[model samples]
Target: MSAFADDTAKDEWKFTLKNAYINRNFENENLKDTGSWSQAASLFYNSRMVDTPLTITDKPLKIGVDASVQYAVRLSSDKHVADTVLPFDRETQSQAPDYLKHGATLKLGYDKTLLSVGELWLDLPVTAVDASRQLLTSYWGTNLKSQLTDQLYAEIGRVEKVSPRNAEDFQKFSFTSNGKTEYSDGLNYIDLRYQVMPSLKAEYYFGNMQDLYNKHYLGLDHSFNTENFTLGSKFKYFNAKEDGNNFNIDAQNIGLLETLKVNNHTFGLGYQQIIGESAYPLPDGFLPETYFINWNATGFFKKDEKSYHFIYGYNFKDYIPGFNAAVKYVYGDSFKTADGKENNESESNIILNYAFQQPFLKGLALQYIRIDYNVEHGNDFGEDRLFVNYTKRF
Candidate 1:
């Protein structure tokens, strides 16, 4: 950037490069004792796509380009299994490692508004896919976001293609793992957030996933800060219905979470209820719309299920900066499955995270997550995961 910058120019266009790598170790105690340890790298080139060399423009608008390629290499001791190391070396759950994760993107922006079209990253709750494994899930579509006012913001988007975090190549919208059907309607969304007061804020989101399903979400957040601690509360509700043939499902989910943070210690309690449906109609879609404090393992959304979670966290910043730990326990019951029998389940999760503050590794992070799920009737399993992540920008 320093080499391309010139104060004399009206608008400056700079080219840059960045890269990220992740080493993941995923172990399962109940799934045939199989584990997969893999390492993946994504190289990003932030440059224009045009082949011809063009002069830089100095104007009020800023134009940029981005492209990325990701490759995954499984460890020598490979235990080939389903759902082992996702988005990496797997034929059933994801694409094999040979298919590289690649995409090209273009951006046009100025001031507080921006327009993006191409293969891009959209992390919206129900719209965003995962990158937890070796590669990230990117969407093919267009988006527009702008700050309408000092207290209000709006975003609108239409995503036509999806390459899931655990899959290679783009596919159409579907509720199945292998997407053999494509939808021309695609997915559309509109979201808005407003700051009602210094201590209160509200957000609304609406999405239509072509002929599959659609959802409406409303949320409110309120927080209070005192000399000793801070208190926060969130309330969210969502209603979903099938559009055409959504596997015959319609559901409503409501959630509430309250947290109290005092220095290094924090505690939280959350509750979520799933009403109606054949599992919320989001099994194979994007992330669920649940705001539960303990969103781990299975979503715990059955035909008629109620879930409760307890959480505790601590930030060891005083002793070690950029270090934190948290644990949560969740239980779900009062569920009616296909057999008309009551089902019950429980889950426990623990995670430890550390972010590097050292100058040489400022953007590096390490995390360990362990989750245990117990079902009264269905399958029971436990997972242990370790992640080493790094990111940087110059």
Candidate 2:
């Protein structure tokens, strides 16, 4: 026993540590009074994979465990600003001084299939957890993934609860509309993907929230490659409707994107439209993954809205290694509010990113984002965000 313990102590464990600081301010008079200066930290651990005697197709079973914890706080001289920026508990009606999140999961694999149970992250078209904030949202449930053939894949899962990005504990899933919120029993989903050829792929997804709503998604992606440049195109569609005992929900969304990459530069154009009486509905605190081309800080999912966007990006690796920049602009109009008020809006964003190339700081990176937004007859605001990240594995 002593020898075994000594040997184990000599081996390094797999872990990661992350830290971030974020600051945001608004331009509107009503919103300028509140600002945010927040800090966050996270730790993750993954156990070494172990091979077990259980086998399905002459291959040994693999088992593992993963755990993570995240904490965040807001700093400000003004109490009102601090309270407004920090995480808030809707039920408690107060600011949370420190938002702490901890969870664990078990993983099992055999040949072409893998199973995960407990707290986990999901990235499906209709039910993806949002990870753009300080802490990522997570779900409590089970998921199974399998590779059926060389070019076909499938995933099925069920989640009962969720830990929101700003919350400390997991809670039941809920849907809110028109100042009314209703909780659902759970959510079930299935996803399928097939690679028709080397350059074309197709995907389909279906999600149902018990007694709440049902959603369906279909997507197609294709690309053409050449020695000098590459061209790509993507199309996405979504349909959603109410289930039972919920609000009357009927929505449809369609998006198309085209891109061309030449040397170190890329250009993109996109169009998105909403074609129903109701605005697109997503799970509370969740975002669509790769299903919405016009989704940025603000989405163009308003009822009967038509939006168009243009994007330009350049990679400066040859001139200045580890540097890239991009700018995007979107214009949306032809939408009406619930009270029949005409509205139009526009948004522009600038993004810059850099990563350290030196061996001593190989995993360190920095990012900056700027946003300018305007509404024809509503509040207007501008925002800025800076991020620093580092990661190491042992």
Poorest lDDT segment (10 consecutive residues) of candidate 1: 11-20
The TM-score of candidate 2 is 0.90
lDDT of 2 by residue, 1-394 (tens): 1121121222233333334444445556665333445566777776645667787667677777778887776654433443233565566545566678889989787666778898978887655666555667788889888888889999999988888776778888888899888888888999999999999999999989888889899999999999999999999999989999678889998999999999999999999998886888866654444469757777878889999989999999999899999999999999986678999999999999999999998888888888888888676777776777776766
Highest-scoring model, TM-score: 2
Please give the distance, in angstroms, between residue 369's alpha carbon in candidate 2 and its true position after superposition. 0.5
**Candidate 1 C-alpha lDDT tens digits along 208-247:** 8888778888889999999999999999888888778634
Worst window of 10 by summed lDDT in candidate 2:
1-10
List the RMSD of every prediction in angstroms: 5.5, 4.7
lDDT of 1: 0.69
As for model 2, its CA RMSD to the true structure in angstroms is: 4.7
Question: Number of the top candidate by lDDT?
Answer: 2
- Report every candidate's CA lDDT: 0.69, 0.77
